[model samples]
Target: MREYEYHAPLSLERLFELAEAEGMEVRFLAGGTDLMPRISAERNQIPRDRKPPMRIIYLGGLGLDEVTDDGESVTIGATASLSALLDNGAVRTKLPALHEALREMAGVSVRNTATIGGNIMNASPAADSVPPLLVLGAECLLRSAAGERRVALSEFFTGPGKTVARPGELLVSVTVKPGRGGSAFRKLGRRKAETLSVVNAAACVELRDGLCESVRIAVGSAAPVVVRCTGAEQALVGKKIDENSVREAGALVVKALSPIDDIRSSAWYRARVAPTMVARALLAAAERKRG
Candidate 1:
């Protein structure tokens, strides 16, 4: 790895100051699970170009690792480890979809070090946490020296590895209101453990007297960004959720996706399996709602 300056700022102010320091290229370090591998790959570039020495700001000291449930909403600090969230009672009971996503992510060791902020900021379409967050109606809280702002998680990502966050901004936390419905997450990968998702899906359903009262569906790895299947959601809302209705709604998911062929799977394969994955998630969510 290339030599870089490392700083562990104890406060957000110090972080911003370090970020604004001229002549130094600044990169924030959360869990380093994703950033470290990418940095190591840079060493193998055939034609290495001269670049500014990087300054790595470690976020651990900034106290951004708390998980709080305020009855109305659950706010998860960005730097909180995936394992920490998995152990939270509010997450397991109130956010089962997210809990399942965390459980299926990587393995125990990786989860101990991987941060939710890093996962979201990485902005991978196949990110395990994103689909559930999208379905749960989560919001990202971004902070900077100037001020702070909140962006809907569904609207956060512009494309792979891209978000609306401005330069000098840091994602502070994510907030999601606990819903009175059931939500589920499903991931399709090459194997079961420690595999990147070929297609992943999440669904939230609220039933009233055996009729779907509200619904949300999101599919990952099927588009440039994780996307909500609004058309499918509209079709399912106010309708009875049965095998046929669920299957029909799942079909609508394909219309919103523009998948691409990659190492894990092909565009055709993704397109084929995405609908079924979504259908399964919806069915599971509906069953949970019934219970």
Candidate 2:
């Protein structure tokens, strides 16, 4: 990477001042999992006008690394590592879908270094944690020198490798409210571990008196950004989640996708496998012990 001045600001205020001074040219170093390699590879290739910053602000001392659950919602700080999330008892018990996603993410070493904020800010179409977050009705907390605002995880991403975070803003935390039912996450990759997903799915469903009370489903690598299968969710709501209903909902998920051919898999393959993945997620969610 280009030689850059490193600033380790001890407080959020100092970090914001640096950001304000540098404007769009300042880059935040969270876990450095995504930033380091990308900057190294693209340093000499990108055009000058579009080049990323050479000023780095390390977030190690900013006290943003935390995980807190108040029984209603779980708030994960920006610098909280994926491995840390996996170790939290509350995360495992209340957010099974998220737990599953974290477990299926890049192996132990990578998880130990990758931060949740980095994963969200990277805005990858196949980001492992995002689908489960979406199903749990997660919201992102963004802060700047000016103030703070909350954006739903569904609305945080604008496109692949893009987000709505402003020039001076930083992602502070992600808050996920507990869903009213069982949840599950499933992903298909070239291998069992340490591989990017070809297709990933998450589902949360509430059953009442043998019928679906509410449901939320999300799929990744099927669109430009992780997307909620609202059509399928609507179809399943209030309906008995039987074999036919599950199959029909899965078909609806496929219909909602906008897949494209890429190095990992063909558009046809993604489209074909999407329904089964959705069905599997639903079945897994349905099987989760009802609270």
Candidate 3:
């Protein structure tokens, strides 16, 4: 890899000061799961017309690695590793779908090194944790030298590998209010595990008096960004969830997807399986809720 200055800031204040410095190509380094690979590729051959970073501001020493609850919401700090998430009881109990996604994300080694912030900030449409988090109505907390701001997770991504966060802004944490019902995440990949998703779906439903009071359905890797199946969710509300309703709602999910033919799968395959995955996720979620 090309030699670059690495600064391990002692505090958030020091991190901000370094980020604000003018005319320097600065990339915030967290987890090193994604950044290391990219850096190695750049060293071998720089991307055409792309500017190389002058420095990497490592956040490991800054202590932004905690998972805590504030009664209503769970805040996952940017530096909190996936292994840390697997051990948090509150996260597992309150956000079962997210827990499931994390458990299946990758093997033990990758999970130990990959942070939640890196996963979100990578902004991949196929990110395993995103659809689950999206269905939970999560929000991202961003900080810069100036101040901090909160952006709904649904609004965070503009496109694949792109987000609304500015160059100087650092993603600090992700926040989500616990939902009342059980949820499920389903992913389709080239392999059974340790692979990128070709299509993935998640469902969250709150049942009251045997009727769906509230519902959220999100699909990923089938669109430019992870998307909520609002029409399908609307159809599920106030209705008893059954095989027929689920099948119909699943059709609506297929209608909502805009999958493209990629190396992982064909658009036809994704379009066909999207509804099936949605149905399966919903059914699994309902079963979990009843249990």
Candidate 4:
């Protein structure tokens, strides 16, 4: 990596001051799992149009690594490691879809070093955490020198690797409201472990008197951003969780998808399998509710 100045600010005030400093290109360092790799690749560039030197502000000292459950919702601090969330009772018991996604993400070692905020900020369409978080109604808390604001996770991503967060703003935490229903997550990849998703799906369903009371479905790697399948969700509500209803809901999900051909899979293949994945997620969630 190129030479750069590093700052470890003990307070958010110091961090914001460093971020807002005039004329310096600044980046926040959380887990560094993603940032470090990108930084190391800069050395291989031709150097004719190299980017400016980066000023990294380490976020570890700012005490933004806590995970707390306040009965109504669970708030995960931006710097909280993925492994930390997996061990939290609220995450495991109250948010099963997110819990399952975290379990299947990368591997144990990488999870230990990857932060929840980093995963959200990276904003990959195939990111495993996003689909489940979207279905669970997660929100992000962004902070700056001016103040703080909350953005719904569904509305946060504008495109791949992009978000609406203003300049000089830091992602402070992600808060998710737990649902009374059951939820599930499913992923398809080249291999079972340590692989990026080709397509992933998540669903949360509430059942009442053998009928679907409500449902939320989200699919990743099927569009530019992880998206909720509201069409499918609407179709499933008030219907019995049976073969025909599940199949119809699955088919409706394709209307919301606009997948592209990529290194891992083809657009046709994703479209073909996406419906099955969505159906499976819904089936699993419904079974969980019944159990």
lDDT of each: 0.92, 0.89, 0.89, 0.91
For lDDT, the strongest prediction is 1
List where candidate 3 sits over 4 angstroms from the true fold. Answer: 1-3, 46-50
- Residue-level lDDT tens digits of model 3 in 83-149: 8998998888898889988888877898999999999999999998999999888999999988999
TM-score of 3: 0.95
Cα deviation at 137, candidate 4, in Å, is: 0.5
- lDDT-better candidate, 3 vs 4: 4
Give, for candidate 1, the lowest lDDT window spanning 10 residues: 43-52
Please provide, for model 2 over 127-223, each residue's C-alpha lDDT reduced to its tens digit, 9 standing for 90 to 100.
Answer: 9999999999999999999999999998999999999999879999999998578899999998988999999999999899978999999999989
Which segments of candidate 4 are over 4 A away from where they belong? 1-3
Candidate 3: the clashing residue pairs are none
- What's the TM for model 4? 0.97
lDDT of 4 by residue, 201-229 (tens): 99999999989999999999989999999
Model 2: what TM-score? 0.94
Displacement of residue 1 (Cα, Å) in model 1 is: 9.2
lDDT of 1 by residue, 1-291 (tens): 355899999988889988886776788999999998887777667536677778889999989999999998999999999999999999999999999899999988999999999999999999999999999999999999999999999889999999998877999999999689899999999998888899999999999999999999999998999999999999998899889999999889999999999999999999999999999999998988898
In candidate 3, how many Å is residue 235 off?
A: 1.2
